[model samples]
Structures are given as C-alpha cells and as structure tokens.
Target chain A: MTASRKPVPKPTPDTQPFWDGTAAGELRVQRCAACSRHCFYPRPSCPACGSGELEWITASGRATLYSYVINHRPAPGFEDDGPYAIAVVELEEGVRMMTNIVGVEITPENLELDMPLQVVFEKRGDMHLPLFEPTGAGL
Target chain B: MKDAVVIAGAAESDELGKLPHLSTLQLQLGSARNAMADAGLTKDDIDGVACVGSPIQIAHSLGITPAWLDGTGVGGSSFLFHVRHATAAIRAGLCHTVLITHGESGRSRVGAARMAMGPDSVLGQFELPYGVLGPTTTFTIPALRYMKETGLTHEQLAEVAVAQRRWANLNPRAAMRDLITVDDVFASRMVAYPFHLLECCLVTDGGGALIVTSEDRARALGTAKPLVHVLGTGESADAPIISQMEDFTSSKGFRLSSAAAFAEAGISHDDVDHVMIYDAFAHVPIYGLEDMGFLKRGEAGAFIAEGHTSPGGRLPLNTNGGGLSYTHTGMYGMFAIQEAVRQLRGEAAAQVPGAEISVVLGNGGMFASAATLVLAGHRG
Candidate 1:
C-alpha cells in the first residue's frame, strides 16, 4: 500500500515570522516589552497586559517535556508516524511549545517528567517545521 | 437590561445514542420543527436563526430565510451566546422570534476533509505541528494540571462520571444509560492521562433547539403554564489555544462571565437553587464550579465527593444526565439551557423539586470561551 503524504500546515501573516524562523533553524517567540512576558502562537498584541509593543526574539530552543501522550492511531498522512510522542515542551524561557518528541520510541516506562529536549527542524514543502528530539540521542 | 425570555419552545431530535438513521441536517430539521410546534408557531415565525456550523445552509434547508442571521460558531456555548444576541435583537425590535439550533452526527463516518474550518484552524499551522490536536488532548492537559494542583485523585474525577451516569439512567432519552461506577471510569481506556473514556462525553447524533421571544409576546401566545425568565446573560473569551492560558487550573473567562451574569440576575451564587453546567468532560464542571464561585479553588473535587452536586444535594447539577451522559450533539450548551428551563417549569422528568432559580453555564471551545445564563421561575 502506498503511504499517504504528510499533512502540511499553512501559515498566516500573524504566524509567518515564527514559521520563517523555524525554517532558518532558529526558534522564535514574541516577547512583550511592556509586560516582559514571553508568548507563543504569535498574536497582534500581548495577551498578558494587552500591549501592542511586542518583538520576536530568538529562543534557546531548549525545553523540558512538560507532558505528552502517544498516539497509536495515525491520521491519513501520518500512518508511518504511528505511535509518535506528542509532547508539550516548556522552553527554558518559560514559554511552552507543543511539538513531537523524536529520536526515541515512546513508552510509559521510557517517558519521564521534565525530560530535556532540543528543537530540530523537519523540512516539508518549503517549510521547515520545528520538532523536538531528545538531547544526546545524536539526531 | 431587556426582559428577554425563552418564550416559545425546545425539543431534542432523537434520544441520545448511535443514530444511523438520521444525518446532521435531518436532526436539525426535526428538532427545529418540534420547537416550532411546541411554541404553537411555524417556520415563518422565525425571523432570526442562530446556530453553529453552516447556519445559513441549515436555515436554507429548513426553508428559513431570516432577515437577521447569526452563524456565530463558538462550539458548545454557541447556543447561549446566540440567546444573548437574539435577546438584544428582539429587544431592538429587529426580529420577533429567534430559533437557536444545533445538531451533529459526531459518530458519523464523515472524515476530517469534510469538517468545516474552525476558529482554531490557524493553530494547526504552529500548534498542531507538535500534536496538540483535538479538544480531548488539549482539555486533558488542564485536567491533569488541575489534578496535580488540587490533590484530586483519578477516582474523584470518576465520581462525576458515575453521578452523571446515574442521572442518565433516570432520563429516558439519554444516549448511554449503562450503569457506570468509579471503577468503570478509571478502568476505561485512557484517551488522555487523567481522562478515561467514561469520563468523556458521548459522541451522538442528535439535535436541540430553543425559541427566544419577548416577554410580552410570550404572555400573548400563552402556550406554557410557567414562564421561564432569561434573567441575565454574559460571555467572554480566553486564549484560543489552551497552551496560552494564564493558568490551566482556572478559567478567567468563566469567572468573568459568571460574575457578569450573576450581577445582572440580581442574585448571588447562594441564591441559585440549581445549576446546569455543561459537562463535555468531567473536569469541565470541576473547573466551571470553581470559576462560577460555587466552590473555592481546589475544592471542586472534595465538593463533588461530598455529593454536593448530586441529586438531593446542595446543588442539583446536570439533572438531565448532562452532556456527559445525555446527548452531547457537538455543542451542548443549548441542552443545558433546555434542562434549566425544564427545571424552572417543574416539567423535567428528573426535575429538581422547587427549582425556582436555576443557573445554566455554557462552555465552548476547549475552555476558550464561556457564556452564563441565569433563569428564574415566574412568581405569579
């Protein structure tokens, strides 16, 4: 059977910068200067203090696996990626990002709270999406 | 401000469960007609139609061409928000009667390709890349966080599932009336950590409708005995993405909306005789109760365990099985309102006795938005 192609996300103007940074092998997030709070999924204004003064800054791309779940059933395009670990990674900058955990098979026995991970870009049709692989796995 | 009332009627399509016979459209039309008949009116009386997911198309299918149409699709709470909007429109003399409806074959074989684009479709670009995915997983994170913070064990959450199931058994129209226990809840497959299959809501093919009209018009028609007054309504939005919330343990939108609603109703939490909280998932009511000021932070688990929310308790919640056991036709807030009205009218099959003041809380969009309505029984 032919493997279904993976699904590609289309970025909008509000989120283009974040996707662009990922393609360049850099993690970017909006930090509000007024409230000094880091935000993700870029918006027009700061959610914390409702400040329009925000700027994109490069992140360290280091995060800890806050929580995750293993999806055994894959979607149409994600058949080969079955049993993948979908995790919520809390970046060192205090911003949490949702991404897949790669480089290791996911099992309840293997998964631990606060596992350190680093971002790795996966190129998909002119877009390099940011995904995290466990550090020291030599990905 | 305006004396807006649920004057006309309400009805559910089929009893909750697997409905292979009807499509979403069929369910919508069936419930819409029932509501009109119950109101002693016809489709021509519906000048405004508000709904979620393809309201215009559904209206056209139902042969309804409204002068004012609001297709504000805010998930489960869409119906309550529609009530608030419809109330304003009716007060402004825009439309005489408005029909708010919802239906979904949640268990249907319709693939994601045919699914309508949601407000969060943009999040798929960045958030879905990491697999945040559907409402179940997204809601699970906060539920887990709530568990961690409140010392609520997995069993306490199960109590909600067990209680709602018990209520469903009394409800003839409930989808899943199988007697469930805390063990059943915990042993059920884990859709996400801290959320078992039993703890989640049913995916049934059903539809519900509510007819909103002016107080004067309602007294004129005089079909029903007791008039259920729409005391107040409030709505607020949170972060569209669950990850962006300031705290997962609490929802500010719920808190704000409830405060506004309570203030407008000229009542406090203590005055509420019954509450019909949307229970899409077990934790939703936990968070909702806390946000609605029924319990202190981290106290919902203990409050629920104490049987405060069960039948004959201090607060009779989800008296009609709730979305957890009753029909969860995608958006469930309308059903909550229907139950509230039934309780106030003393016509509920499992009616909370002497329920004069009832509060209905509607949650939509993964704890993203909330709408609260306070309904009081008419005192002659």
Candidate 2:
C-alpha cells in the first residue's frame, strides 16, 4: 500500500501573479516605478518610498545565498522532503527571496556565504514553485 | 506630556509548560483579575484592553470599549508595544487605566491551525514558502552564525539556560524550577545545531496582564510603595524578513530602540541596575545586551560567562525566571516589565540587591520588531 500525498497550497488572488510567472519559466518581482527600486512578495506600493506606481519586471533569476539552514525534521506535509535546505536568497535585483536550495547536497561543507545561485522551478499539479540551485561562481 | 505610570498591577496565570485544565480565555481573565486586584482596582476601572491573538473578543469579553484598542499581534513583544500605546493614551487622557494581556496554549495548539496574514503583511508570501513555520528554527540560524563568529561554545550558551533555571527554583510560580546544569544543557537533545533542547524556551499554556495608569492615580490608590516609573519607551522595526537584516549576529532594532529609550530617559547603559530582557531564546538577550550597549560587540558570550547577568552580578537579568524558565505566554515583553517592577518594589522572589533602575527590552516578531522600556523607582 502507498501513502497518499498531502495537498499543496494553491495560489490566491494576491499571489497568483508570482505563481503564474514561475510557471512560465520566468522570475518576476514588483518594482516601484516612482522610486525605481525592486520589491518582493508583490505589494501595491513600494515600501521603501511609499509610491503607488509599481510594475512587475522580469528578474535576472540570479542570486547569492545570504543565509540558510538544513531542516533535519520534516514538516507534516513535506515528510518525503526531509533534511531539505531552506535558504534566503539575495537576488541580483536587490530583493531577498526565501526559497529552497535544490540540485545539491545541503551541508555546512557545501553551503557558504555569498554562494552563486540561479532560479529553477518545481511543478506541483497546477502550481509551479521557484527553487534555487548553485551556479558556478561568475558574474 | 504627563507622566504615565504602571499604576495598576501585573500577574501571570501559570509558569511555562503545558496546562491542560485552563483554556486561553480563562488564563487571560485570571491574569487580568489578578493585575486589577494588585493595582487595587476592578474591572469597572479599566477603560482599555489590549491583547494578541485573543480568543475572547477584547471589547465583548473584557466588557470594556477601550478608546485605544491595539490588538497588534507581534508574538512575545506585543505586550510591550501595548504598554507604549497605553502610555500615550493615558497621557492624552483617552483612558485612565489600560489592561495589556496575552495567553497561549503553545504546546497543545501546535500544528492546530495555519496562520493567516493580511495582504499588506510583510510575511504574507515571503516567509510562508521557505518552511520557516516558527520562530525557533528561524532564530537558530542566526544564533548558530553568532556562535561561529564569536567562538561562543555550547557551554557558554548553556549558562544562560542554567542561570535562568536557578532563578526559577526560587519562584513557586515558575514551571521548570528543577535545577539544570551546563552539562545537562550540552547533553540535551539537539533541536538544531548550536541550540540544544535545553537552550530553547518552553512552549506553555499561560497568560500575563499589566495595568497602566497616570502617576497621580497611582499615588491616590496608594497600594504599593516604591513606584516603578515608566521613564522612557522606544520602538523600531528592522527588515520584516530575517534575511534582509543588515547583520544576523546583531539586532539593529535593539540598537535603535535602546538608543531612543536611553536618550529619552536621560540615562546611559551604565545607569541600569538590573535588566529584564525578553529571553524567548537564549541568544535574544545575548544579542540584545550587545545591541543595547550593555556589552561590547562580539563579547556577549564572555559577558554572560563572567557572571555579569547572573544572580548578584552587576546586572541581574530576568529575576522572575524569564521566559526561559518562567511563563512565556506568547509575547513575553509584558512579563519582563512585570519582573522589572517586582525587582524595583523589592518583591521579586529572587530579588537583586539595590535594583532601583531596571531596563526592560522587548522583541516582538521574528527579531524584526523591538521595543525598549526603562523603569526607575522613585528615590523620594
């Protein structure tokens, strides 16, 4: 007998754009036109300058691992994905994104500050989530 | 602005750990009533009610329509924020007496529900995805980094846990009053690297409340001597996301908040006699002490090891056992203030000698929001 899989979170209206962008194999973040600063998590206005004029812009999909931790214990829904590497990626666009580090073994020996990375997508049914993988150190 | 004072009272429902008998509302009400009585006041006298994630609707259950109702839900720091808000309200004459309350069944309520964040919430989509479900795991990352940078050994961090537990033994209300040693801490199960199970704080079902009023009203009531004055209050926000912080090894919000508080109080870190720092995790106070200028940068481990923050040290901290061994009640800033008051009144179960000026530092949400409050006993 096989165990059933847990339900994945669906993208709500507030987060649909972000999920939609990821499904199209693109990384997009909200950029405030007034302040010309990029922001994350899709806000109506720029938190930096409080400008109401904001637009979604394609990102370089490149970043560095700012900080991370290897979760030894699995969450309830993510039992199969135990000991996953969760990271906070500082995007080249100057916005910090929380994503999982994939395509590499997560260990203190492997994980280092300012490690170069690039965005990748993992599909779960209709949803496509963005994950990051280490890229060779180069600008 | 007029002088705002903690004229009323403060109380906790229970110490840290599980409490199956009482509901969240019961704990809140119990602590609220105790605080009211401590201030020699009653429910009728309260004009404001503030809480974080309260099951009992504030105005309806508490039977008070506060002119100022702040249900700003910042875990562990909400009560301190409420105190700051209550002070402003009292100065503006909006309310004479304000009740700040909090309660949590953390042990039992774990994994019971999903958090719902508003669209404007910085954490709405940013944090939920990365499996940063709780504060403990998120905080551990930075703590581990701090240890690596400062050469802080596990034994040094364990000293904080052990010291707090020793203080807990003096208070009958404390939960984990059993003596814990540095060896016991290092030997405990590893919840996360650099954070043993003993190094973490208790997730308990408990509640706390504080009553705030004008200084004149406190003088009229005349219940307790050596009034603990709210000398100054300061609050600040760093990046909402833990990753965006300028420095993981330190708290910028603590520096900003403490600077403003000390300046407003017309005092320096050297003037502080004792401290009631929010100790949700052992590293919080370590970082807080450094950020508040109480200790030099990268010296918190040695500062704690040298017995500066221990009992009878230069600055005895968390004398009421703190959140580590005492009641956590979700947002623990109010309890820190409560402990500071107890020490000022010479009423703490583990009273620090000559504790006239106490500093209370509060951390609200994920090391993002912080508030500092200075309380001084009237010399006259």
Q: Give the winner by TM-score.
A: 1
Clashing pairs in 1: A99-B130, B16-B175
Q: Which ten contiguous residues of candidate 2 chain B have the minimum total lDDT?
A: B111-120
Identify the runs in model 1 with alpha carbons over 4 angstroms from their true place. A1-4, A33-36, A48-53, A65-73, A76-84, A102-117, A122-126, A133-139, B54-65, B109-113, B116-121
lDDT (Cα, tens digit) per residue for candidate 1, span A14-111 = 88888789888999999999988998878899878999999999999898877665654454556666566666788988988777787777775566
For candidate 2, the lDDT comes to 0.76
Q: Give lDDT tens digits, candidate 2, residues B1-380.
A: 44656635877664546877677666677788777777777777778888876423755676766666777776677777787788888888888878887666666663223455542355645555556556666766676567667777777888888888878988888878898888999888766555677877777777777888888887776745456778888888776767666687888888998998898788877788998888888888889888999888778877787877777777788888888888775667777887888888888889888778898899977788898888877631
**Which 10 successive residues of model 1 chain B have the least lDDT summed?**
B111-120
Candidate 2 docks at the CAPRI level of acceptable
TM-score of 1: 0.90
Q: What is candidate 2's DockQ?
A: 0.32
Q: Show how many residue pairs clash in every candidate, following the order shown.
A: 2, 2
Q: Categorize the docking of model 1.
A: acceptable
lDDT of each: 0.78, 0.76
Candidate 1 on B273-373: residue-level lDDT in tens? Answer: 99988898898888889999998999888788778887778888898889888878677887898888888888887888888999888988878889998
